[model samples]
Target: MDRFTERDQLIRKWIYAAAATIKESFDDELDIERKSNRNDLVTNMDKAIEKQFIEKIQHFFPGERILGEEGLGDEISLLDGVVWIIDPIDGTLNFVKQQDDFAIMIAIYEDGKGQLGYIYDVMQDKLYSARTGKGAYCNKRLLPTIEDRPLKEGLVAISSALMSKEEGLARTVGRASSGVRLIGSAGIETAHVASGRLIGYLAATLAPWDIAAGKIIAEEVGLIYTKLNGDKVDLLQKTPVLVASPTAHKEIIELLKSQKI
Candidate 1:
């Protein structure tokens, strides 16, 4: 097998192992700490899981660069080499409070090109993965390509905070789509879009690790992923993101322009 194939196997193994460790930690008292604010929290499980993936990556791919959410990876100044973008626990609040709805995400990019993406819904035991030029999958089942669906007929996912702050967005989405859902987990929301469960997902602000893997999987399934202004999403920058079906993507952009959002 080629290098990517080999790495894919390794990643699957590591992810399952990490998931077991995380699940076990739920039985113990969590060491939680606030990051940017009280709402932005981190737990000891997040750090430990990140460390586990980092150690395996370093041992297996010594020179590869890693940009991780937990800050346990390498100091990646550029996306030039083989880079691993990881979010150990995408929805930390859900994991801490509800013990569900969170996900572990990892993306492998070689010289700025996405090679593989993995989003494991740990609580649900669903693994969404995709390889470049290969089809996306939910566990062993292949995900169908996203069919064209008009914005008005489809369900859109957005953050509750964004919905409240941006009246224009709420109005546009409310009027255009069937309804809106606030899942509080970017990875899970993105997976829903990729799997055709949701027509689109819009985030007011998202970090690189938040959407890196989802972007790869979304693109493989023929979904359009871009900034709100229809710009290409930069993997190294945090910005507003929209992942949607082609029809919904065009319609949403038009609505945003009409509202100047």
Candidate 2:
């Protein structure tokens, strides 16, 4: 098997095809429904797009396992072989409300190691993709090497939920960065980190589907992708995750540990 094409090119084509389908599905208005809460949303477009990805993968790569949002894929308990993790709509809320700022994220792992990652910002027509040993890219351009920047010198991405769960994180973000920005999608935030727009990102409760592509591309550019306490991330579980340049990652972790909220 052509490992790179199986992982990167196929998924990239899948995302583009899914994007077209989703765009047509939502040309007028979206049928948005709450998943867990008002804050957690699911749309018909989300389901359709996810289904499209799952079906394409099943057709092209018959034996591969899929772990996708919207429950369109198989019930997977282990990541043993070729595993595809998909977030059909990375920002469903944004897609439903603003029709922008959402993304389609796909990541493929072989034996639990990231082999390919793709994050497509549908609204902006941007695709961020990476393959193991090939480096990351934003559309056609290869991403530059990630340079370590201090917290005070660059913007940092943090979720608003941290303000309630970890009180000090909000305060720390307020004091630490030149600015604090909240983009509803983890994929977008991590893409920014990969491109050197944001120095760091931290979120408390994220699903595996949410950050899989983000973590892969972030690390491809020499950015640190790990748990909040600086542990390696497990692609099958949820955790408090952080992605950032090396300097900002260390600083943010130390700050979070000290406050301990």
Candidate 3:
């Protein structure tokens, strides 16, 4: 347990160091590349930051399995042991364009349970983190717990694509809340929910690194995180996701369940 704490501290320091390196690397001349398609993207900084973190993790905790967004880590087909999920840059497009609204996401799992989570808002210099038994925090301050509230009065967080394009998700957003918004990053959206800036967040598609940390930290504040269809989300798979205050989550899930994609 004490060793875990020490390792946790080391990882936090590494996250800060990685963020600093990333901030310095962000320039107008980013080495950007297309992946999957034109809209899907990757950048030199993305790979560099991911490799930096992975290198440190390997140096300190050898044999731990890692699943990174940039494919720099191990390709574990299952989540059966000590594992790390890393999204070196959560908003690569934003990083390449605005250099803001991006995050470094990390999640630690031990024997199939989320043991710890971290989301670093690099530009803002805020680090959000939590251990399973510990409450979530932004920097040193604890995140306020979200109240259980229904959707009609709650501000919703969602992406433009899902709000307008994904039919079932779109209608769920349209009918389940007072408003819908997009911040372009799962880490940012979920961080806002942890801080009570929004009551819920939904995304149509995401990788493990995108939601693993957010899910751990959000649920620490009494938030509910599940798939859009309300199933267990394998932290190792691509899936639709929803995170919300429990009451708000219930409403969103019902709406999603009743609609068609």
Q: Which has the greatest TM-score? A: 1
Summing lDDT over every window of 10 consecutive residues in candidate 2, give the lowest-scoring window. Answer: 1-10
User: In candidate 3, which residue pairs get closer than 3 Å at backbone N, Cα or C atoms, i.e. clash?
Assistant: none
Instruction: List the candidate 2 regions with Cα displacement exceeding 4 Å.
Output: none
Clashing pairs in 2: none
Is 1 or 3 the stronger prediction by lDDT? 1
* Predicted candidate 2 versus true structure: per-residue lDDT over 1-261, tens digit per residue: 676775566777888888888787766667778888888999888888888888888998899999998988989888899999999999888888777888999998888898889999998899999987789999999998898888899998887666567766777765888888888898998998999999998888789999788888988999999888888888778888889899988888888788763
Model 3 segments more than 4 A misplaced: none
Clashes of each: 1, 0, 0
TM-score of decoy 3: 0.95
Worst 10 residues of 1 by lDDT: 159-168
Model 2, residue 104: what's the lDDT?
96
lDDT (Cα atoms) of all candidates against the true structure = 0.92, 0.86, 0.86
- Model 1 backbone overlap count: 1
